[model samples]
Target chain A: MNAIEIKGLQKNYGDFKLGPIDLTLPEGCIMGLIGENGAGKSTTIKAMLDMITAGGSIRLLGKDARESSALLKQDLGIVPDEIGLPEGLNIRQVEKIMADSFRNWDSKQFYDYMKRFNLPEKKAFKTFSKGMKMKLGIAIALSHKAKLLILDEPTSGLDPLVRDEIVGILNDFTREESHSILISSHIVSDLEKICDYIAFLHKGKLMLCDEKDRLLERYGLLQTTPEILRDLDASAVLGKRVTDYGAEAIVARDKVPQSFEIQPVSIEELFIIMAKEA
Target chain B: MKGLLKKEWYAFLQKPVTFLFPLALFVVLAIQTKSQVILMYLPLYFGILPVTLMSADEVSHWERYMHGLPYSRSAIVSEKYVTVLILSVFSMLVSGVLLFFFMNTGFAVPQFLFLIAAAFAASVLLPSVMLPLNLRFGAAKARIALGVIFAIFGCLAALSVDDEGGSRFQLLEKLAGLNISIGALTGILFAAAAVIMAASWCIALMLYRKKQF
Candidate 1:
């Protein structure tokens, strides 16, 4: 079964509109949503969670998203960019609250994650650092035994060490075949490390969605003179940069002539090129 | 529901002084002055506690985070109403104890019960107006709206005095003229408060459901 399926999702504010987006995340696979700021990544996530009234049909675990029942929520764990626990709540109090909130809450797992993450049990949320807060959020999201996790910018502002640790934890989560994740982040490198599928959003529209490996295979970076780049087919060059010394362009591998050498493009490079082009 | 309450409980404990100061003041003043009139304001204070908590929730952005949880919109709206009711009952119980002590000071048994009922009605009625506004416009804006409402009511109340030594004496005289028993008046107040509270809950739920975080 697919973990999440969204069809024709759209939301409109007076000044901005996010739209008609269709996305599907297959069960047990992680799909990374890559976008720049205001690219509608968070908006799409909100729509899928039914946090906003959007024009769309969303199904989570075969249940309608609008049917936000406790049973449906029990199987879904979510982490927003900022963990929004009351500042005065200590770890123990948060555990107590979660215990009362979720019938399947595992206190042992929570404590274990706290210990592993080096989060202080006695400290209030207000005292925790940003990295600690994020670790705590991830710990809570993992301890609940949720089948699907929706994380929004979970690793955006963290240091590289903390980001790597979080990435490792996410990798561990997907070890279970039933556990899936739909994570949105502007930090493409982190997503590249863990995501099997990639979806790029630019200006509220989905630019492309495909397997990460397929994207890397289909697009290659070409290093040549501006004249050579200019000579290439417009359709072949997805994005380009021409300096006085030389020129570099993202070219469709199949469309490029065999005479030109094509280097594999990283997901970050691909996203930047694609987003800039859009 | 339990989780939301637990959160509020922790929040209450965080600033116990903020929540308990009014009650303590009411107790001290009632004891020192030997007056039951101060008991009326205790429930009014308790009724606004939910709005105060909502301000904290706004600062922490818990309301937005809560949407990611399993709770429905109605549950979210219902929690505030429940919190108001809980605080109202606590205020009533505290006032009941105070009224019990006032029994020796010429306070009649029926009047004592009526006072509690009146306090309860005021407690629920205040939040009935405040919660919907808070849900519709958020905590900060709702606070302004509430201030305007209170100001209007205060002005209307001031106008009703007719310069005849205030409205309290006039109200008592009118009530006496009506010849309604304290028991019947208490029942009417309780029934009116209940109906208003139920309607307020529906309004709050509707407003909250339409709100986009």
Candidate 2:
């Protein structure tokens, strides 16, 4: 069985709908779930943890998510989109709390992360800056020897240096292929660096789920004339951007016509073309 | 779940509201109602301590953070229940002494047991009513709903207070000639009410477990 499988996950809130989402994350890989602000990233994560009212079949580590939440959460450590640390707690307090809560929490690992991040042991969380808070969130996430670290926008508010540091830590932490991560972020470049698989969600729907290299290699930014795109194959065309200079067709890069030149698109530009349905 | 409970207690001490409101009301009520020593202080005796603790927690959105910890929903829920149970026992001990000093009516023994039991009954009721609501609408909305429910309950209690009549109270007249010791029966009723309070807490937990937070 896959490390994570979500099938027909349905959750509705009046006009807001979460799914009919179907996805799978094979073991021993990082899967980046890319989406915009309101594109149901957090909702899907919540549903996966059985933290919200949801109807679906979800298997994380070969157990039903709802029936086996108590056991499943042992392997799963979730750091939400927002760091929900207690305002009164210091870094030390957080370590104590996490240690007491998670049976597998590694106290030495927690303090090491805190030291690496330069998070103060005595300062209350409320006194920490936004970046420090996110660091604290990261520290807690890494402390538990978790098999699956489900991080939502873990580095959204940090500086590039801190972001690099955190990314380096995550890369090192997952040294044993036994650990996997399903991280969601709007920062596609960050995801590009770590994630082996990529899933794009747009307006509560799954746009595509594929390998990072395949997605990058497959999608091409053809910046030739609009007339050129009109004469080319339309079936494989995922999206287009029209500008005064020319038009850009998000065509399969490997499949581009011999007549026109192709340019590489970064993950962000690729998402801009392919992830948006409208 | 010890993490959640420790955090709850740590956070509680940092805020003045948790102890201040209960202490203020307990003292004020101790001075009211010709000093029944236990019944008039019923608001404090019944639910004040737990209410303060739970309300403080509600204000902090601690449950959301607690969910980040590796704890079963049932364990988290039971911690809240048990916290209230512990606080109720503490409240009876603290307030029972205060009652003795205030009434000077030899209430140390019987009233201690009665107040402890009744206070627990009251403490349990607030969470029993508020927990599911908190799960559905969160702390802010649940606080408003709880305010309204308790206000309505307070009004009903006030309206039922005795008028000048041959009987000490209207409720007393209604139960006249019954061989039951009203005080003893009330203690029994409160105990039964406490059981329902605990049961409702379980139901709220089950509901909250599936609720989107």
Candidate 3:
């Protein structure tokens, strides 16, 4: 079964709207949801999790998000961008609460992560720094052995040292082929490193989604004369910018005949190029 | 449910205010035996602060985190009622022990029992008002709503006391009718209150479960 699927999802805020988004993430793969600030990435994630009273259809683990959410959430682990840990709940108290709350909570694994993260066992969470608080969130999300993990910018404020540790943890989870991760982030480079697939969202709509390598292979920017730009099919172009001298344009990388000069494009560059329309 | 209650209990203990509960009343009790009026009132007051209004768990926005865990929304709400129930019982016991030492000379058990029950009811009402308010408007707005309600009640209560035989006086007259024999009546009131609480709790749970975080 696919780990996650969303279709025609709609949510309206007074000033902002989300979705009518369609996307999927297969089991045992990392799908990076890439978007700029205020681009509706968080809204889509909240709706998919049924955290919001959303307007369309969403399915996680093949069950509708609203009707069968409780059962579906069992296999899912989520870390929202904001810290949700209750202050003054030490690590020990958190474990007790989780153990009672999750049928599949792994005691040994939870404690093992606490040890690995160097989190204080008895220190109150109110005293925890931003990075430490995030570590606590990650520990809880990972220790349950969830089949589908959803994270919202899990590394926003961490030092590089802690960030690498979390990346290593995500990599290990996917390597086992029994788990998948859907990570939403503006940190395009981090997602590029770990995500096997990519979904780009802009203004609450799905712009593009494809295999990571296929994206690199299919989309390319060719700097050329306006005359050459006209030679390209306007239908094949995602977006374009024309300067006084020439036009820089996005075309299917492989479709741009080998006869033409080309260079590799980074994921961030692709997001900017695709999100910006003529 | 036990897990949730335990968390609530620990949170209460961790808060210095809950600790101040006994401290503040003890000072009042020390001044004069008559001030057992203040001692009898302490538990309900703490209930308002700790159980209903300014809890640490709510401060941290922990309910959002707890949503996907094993507990159901109904379970979470039901546990809150149970927490207040347990706290009321515990606070009643503490009030009894202190009342014992203060009224050791007289053993006025009937009046004392009435006072304890009144304290418990007063404590429970705060949550009845607060739980719905908090669920509807959230903490920031709940504070303002609760403040306004309290201020209005405070002003009216003072006016009623200053103006002899007002509706406030009649409200107390109903309580003053209690005696040792009225324990059965108190028990019935507790039962009715429990039913109303359960109904309110169901509403809060459904509204919260369906809410957009």
Candidate 4:
């Protein structure tokens, strides 16, 4: 079963418009939503979670998102950009609240995550550092026995060490074939480490969505002279930067001549080039 | 619903002073002035407790976060009403006990019962107006609207008073002269307040469903 299926989804904000966006994330796969600030990433996630009214259809866990019944939500673990718990609550208080909130909330798992994350049970949430707060949010999401996780900018503000730790934890969650995740981030490197598939959102439109491996295999960074770059077919060069030393362009692997040397392109480099081209 | 209630309770406890200080002041004033009217304000105070909670939710953005949880919009709206009801009951119990002790000190049984019932009704009636406003325009703007409403009522109340220590006594004399029993009046007030509260819940739920988080 697909974890999420969005078809012709759209939202209008008077000045800016989003979508007619179509996206799919199969069960057991981690799909990374890569976008810059104000690119409608949060807007799309809000629509999928039924937090906002938008046009078109969205199915999550094989159920219509607009229905948004409590039963359906029980299987969804969500970490919004801000961890929205009452700041005055201590970890223990939060655990108690969650236990009552989710029917399948596992206290042992929650506490275990707390210990692993080194979050203090007695410390109020307002006193925790940004990293600790994020870890707690992730712990709550993971302990609820949810089949699908929707994370929005979960790693944006954290340090590299914390981001890596969160990425590793998310990777662990998807070990079970029934578990799936759709994480959005402007921090492309973190998503590159864990996401099986990547979707690029530019402004309010979806620029590209494909398997990470297939994307890397299809695009290459070609470093050659400007004279040679000028001769290259327009279809071959997706985006290019030229200087006195050389010309660097993201080129379609198959479209480029085999005689030219092509280097592997990182996801971050690919996104930057694509966004610049757009 | 339980989870939401628990969170509210925890938040309430976080800064006990905010709730406790007013309660303490009321108790001290009641004792110092030897006035039953001072204690009567307790129910009104409790009735508006949910507004403070709603304000806190806005500050923490919990209102936005809650939409992602496994709760229906109605459940979210119902939780606030439930909290208000619970606080109202607590206020009644506190006032009832205090009034019970004052019964021997010039307060008659019928008068005491009427006061307690009035307090409960007032407790219910105030939130009945405020919660729907809070749900529709949010706590901050709703607060200004509530202040305007209270000011209008205050002016009307002031206008009703006359010389010779005011028309309040004249109104009381008129009420006492009526054939209606205190018990019947109390029952009517209770029922009316409850009906208004139920209607308010429906309005709040409708407004909350339309809210865009």
Q: What is the interface RMSD of candidate 4, in Å?
A: 1.0
Please identify model 1 stretches exceeding 4 Å from their true place.
Answer: B158-172
Q: Is candidate 3 or candidate 4 better by DockQ?
A: 4
TM-score ranking of the models: 1, 4, 3, 2
Separate DockQ for every predicted complex: 0.74, 0.54, 0.52, 0.74
Worst 10 residues of 2 chain B by lDDT: B37-46
Put down candidate 1 lDDT per residue, B1-213, tens digits, no spaces.
Answer: 999998888999999898778778988888778777777888988888887788888888888888777788888899999999998899888888887875347778888888899889978988899899998899889879988998998988877776565664477788899999889998998899889999999999989888877
lDDT of 3: 0.76
DockQ preference between candidates 1 and 2, better one: 1
The native-contact fraction of candidate 4 is: 0.81
* Candidate with best lDDT: 4
lDDT of 1 by residue, A210-243 (tens): 9999999999999999998888899999998778
**Native-referenced Cα lDDT, model 1:** 0.89
For all candidates, the clash counts are 0, 1, 3, 0
Q: Model 4, B109: alpha-carbon shift in Å? A: 4.1
Candidate 2 lDDT by residue in tens digits, A1-278: 47889999888888888778898988778999998988888888888887887878988877888887877887887887667676777777777777778888899888887778888899888898877887788778777878888888888877898788778877886788788889999888888899889988888877888998888788777887888888777776788887899988788865666666777777788788876525
Evaluation by lDDT, superior candidate among 1 and 2: 1
TM-score per candidate, chains pooled = 0.96, 0.88, 0.89, 0.93
lDDT for predicted candidate 4 compared with the true structure: 0.89
Local accuracy of candidate 4 as per-residue lDDT tens digits, B1-213: 999999989988997987899888877777667677788788889888887788888888898888778998889889999999999999888888776764337777787778778888878888899898988788899999999999999998888787664675476678778978988888877888789999999999988777775
Off by over 4 Å in 2: B16-46, B49-61, B97-104, B107-112, B154-169, B173-176, B186-190
- Candidate models: Cα lDDT each: 0.89, 0.74, 0.76, 0.89
At residue B141, give the lDDT of candidate 2: 83
Which lDDT tens digits does candidate 4 get at residues A74-168?
99999988997898999999999999999999999999999999998998889999889889989999998999999999998899999999999
